[model samples]
Target: MRAIQITEFGGPEVLRVVDLPEPVAQPGQLLVDVAAAGVNYADTHAVEDSYLSKSTLPMVPGGEVVGRTAEGRRVVALTDGGGYAQRALAWEAMAHEVPEEITDGQALALVVQGLTAWHLLRTCARIAPGESVVVHAAAGGTGSLAVQLAKQFGVGRVIATASTKEKRELALELGADVAIEAAPDGAGLKEQLIEANDGNKVDAVLEMTGGPVFDASLAALAPFGRLVTYGMASREEPTAVTAAGLMGRSRAVVGFWLMHCVTRPGMYREPMAELFAMTADGRLKPQVGGVYPLTEAARAHTDLRARRTFGKLLLDPSR
Candidate 1:
């Protein structure tokens, strides 16, 4: 099998294509012929050994794949690693059959990015109907879907922040009520968010970028607002938040990791089924930014980290 291997910790340059023997499945696991692999921001962190969990040497970098079992069932698998390959192994429990209507790339998108967006709004944020929500990086994979899911969940308003005007427009097309520029340093970001929500603070925030964005989003929350931090794409330190400050404003700062949800029964399946249904019915559109051939994994990571792409980026292992 051909796979992207990283023997040393570094940047996208470390993702080198290599040929290795195919993996055999253990009991309760399925061997999948990888068709497409989802590329994520976390994959960047994983390569640098800076993720929430450290990476081991001589490992493949992707976790989500859309492929098939030997039995010919089309499925999406959540692997611990080795997804960026022509073949990978998945726990049967972590795999779901893909619908006939959903493309391989779209199914790959649903596994990590789709479920993360769903959990961010539905599980972590506990967003209420008529509540105002802000989704950062709203034009990216998770954020783009989150904007649509927020509307589907009947939020009163969806405020989207993106770094580019074109991306903001795309967010609006995806159902965000308003879209605003995300200034790099987050200068006046709180005011922009509040203003976008019609002179009021937001009820919940799905924040990924750290540093000033986190600081501003925290400040832009309404009383009793929930701020869920999922990623630190900026690789910068966030402003400190004290309990006293949270208590004074009656605000809460929460952190969510999708892997935690994978540990519980039905936690992963239920929301994933919902996302599948949404995608099937055309309610949820999983934006696919670009698809790279198996050997160009480095380029995919480069484009993603540089913010040069949008939606879900994928690697076509068959290519």
Candidate 2:
């Protein structure tokens, strides 16, 4: 099997294609002929030794993958390493059924980004109809699905932010009522968002980028609003928010970590079924941004880090 191996923590060039021995499935795991592998920002972070628990050197990189399992059926997994290869092993518990009607490549897009979006809105926030919601990075993986789910759940209005004009338009196409340019200028971002809402405020905000953007996101919320902060894409270090910031506005600040949810599969089972049905019915759609042959994994990482693509990035390991 050929896999993408990271021997050091650095640039995309560190992802080397190497021919390696195939993995054998353990008692509760499957040896999958990987059809497609989901490439996430976390993959880049993992390669650079910035991930939560930096992986050991010379590890094959990929966390979430959509492929086959021991049961000989299509499924997705939150498995570690091994995914960026022609064949890999996955624990049975970590796999979710990938609808037979969906293509192998499409199945690859559903694992991480789609599930995170589904879980965050439906599980964490529990957004109600007639309420407002905003999804930052609405043109990217989780952001794109968050916009669609907000609409599907009957949220009154959705606001999205993107860094480029094309991305802004992409958000509107994905069901965001309003889409605006994301700014480094926190005050300007807040003002632009406020203006997009007819100067009204949102009932819920998905703040993926932490730091100043988190503060600006809070300012855009309505009283009693719920703000969910998940990623640290903006400022790598922590940012402080005073208790008064939440108390005076009657708002709540909560953190969402998908890894925690992954640890509790029982809690996510029912929702995974619903997501499968939705995807089968053409309701839960993932924008297919780009696909790269497994051997060219380095180029895939380069494209992602350069912000040169939108939607989901997939790896065709068999090719």
Candidate 3:
């Protein structure tokens, strides 16, 4: 099997394609023939050795994948790592049947991205009907799904922040009530979010961009609202916040890490199944931004990290 191997902790060129032995499954695990592998910011973190619990160098670096088991059942799998390849291993518990309604790429898209979106909205934030939400990176993989889920939650208004006009438009099409270019100060964007909700503070915010934007996201929350921060795509430098931000309005701020949620399926099973049901029912349609051959895994990562693609990027090993 050919896989993308990170021999060094550096640039995209460090991700070299080479023939490696195919992975074999252990008891209670299944091997999937890689059909599609999900590219994520997590991959970037791992390659740079910035992620928590960094791996030894030269390991294949992918955190989530969609493929079949050794028996050839059509299924999806989650991995601790090693998905940028022709074959990978997954715990049986992490495996889920891909609904016929979902394309292979869409299935790949939704599993990690979709599952993260599901856990974030339904569990971490517990979005309420009629409340408003501000979704940061609203055009990316997780944000796109968050917008759709906020609609499903019956949020009366949704404020989306995107990196580009084209991506912002995609957020609107995904169901955000209003979409705007994210502001540099993050203050102007707060005002826009308030006005969009009829001068009401946001009921909840799904934020991934870290830094001053995080401070604004918390400040934008409505009295008694919730703010969930999951990623730091924006802030390379840390930003500080005061507890006063939470005290006055009874506003609650929390952090969400989907990896932590996924590791504890006992916490996520019922809802994940429900998300799959939503996919079957056509209430949730995850976008697969681009599909690249597995051999082009480096290009996929480059495209994703550069923010040139929308929705989920998938690698097709079989292709």
Candidate 4:
């Protein structure tokens, strides 16, 4: 089997293509012939050893894949690891049969970014109809889905922020009520968000980037607003929230990690099923920003880290 391995923690160049013996399915696991694999910021973090969990040496970096099982079932799965290979293993419990209407790349996109977007809006933020919401990185994988889902959930206004003009345009195409440029250091972000929302503070905010962006988002929250922090894509040091700052506004800051939900069977399974159904019916569309051959894993990481790509980046192992 051909796999992309990270023998050391560093940059994209560390992702080396190597030949490894095929892995067999363990009890309760399925050995999948991988078709497409989802590339996420987490994978990049794992390669650089900055992820939430430490990765061992010579580790396969992908966390999600859309593939076929030995029995020929087309499925999208959340792999324990090793998704960036011709063959991978998935726990049967975590695998969902892909609907015929969904493409392999789309199915793979839903595994991580889809679930994260769903939980961020429906569960973590608990957004209600007619409320105003703000989504950062609105043209990226999770952001693209979040923008569309917010509108579907009946949000009165969806404000999105992206680093570039093209990304902002894509966010609008995806259903954001307003799209604005994201400042490099989040300067004036609060005022820009309020201006975009008709001078009103947002009811809910999806904040993944830490540093100045988090600071601005936290300040932009309306009274009783909620902000869900999922990741620190900025790679900046953690921001400290003052209890006093949140007291007067009755605002709340919550943190979310998909790994926690994965441990509880129903938590992951239910929303995933809903997302799949929505995708099948054409309600939810997972954008494929770029697809790279397995050997070009390094280039994928480079594009992702540079924030030069929008939507989900996928790797075709068969290539």
Error of 3 at 157 (Å): 0.8
Q: How big is the positional error of residue 56 in model 2, measured in Å on the Cα after superposition? A: 1.7
Answer with 1 or 3, whichever has the higher lDDT.
Answer: 1
Candidate 4: where are CA atoms >4 Å away?
Answer: 238-240
**lDDT score for candidate 4 against the true structure:** 0.91
- Candidates 2 and 3, the one with greater lDDT: 2
Residue-level lDDT tens digits of model 3 in 78-190:
78789888888888888788766767877777777777887778787888788788888888888899899889988888888887999999999989989988775576777
lDDT of each candidate versus the true structure: 0.92, 0.81, 0.80, 0.91
The 10-residue segment of model 4 with minimum total lDDT is 236-245
User: Candidate 4 residues 119-163, lDDT tens each?
Assistant: 999889999999999999999999999999998899999999999
Clashing pairs in 3: 32-68
RMSD of 4: 1.0
Model 3 clashes, total count? 1
lDDT (C-alpha) at residue 286 in model 4 = 92
Q: Please provide, for model 2 over 138-167, each residue's C-alpha lDDT reduced to its tens digit, 9 standing for 90 to 100.
A: 998888889998999999889998889999
TM-score of 4: 0.98
Stretches of candidate 1 off by over 4 Å are: none
Best by lDDT: 1
Candidate 3: 10-residue stretch with minimal lDDT? 233-242
TM-score of each: 0.98, 0.94, 0.94, 0.98
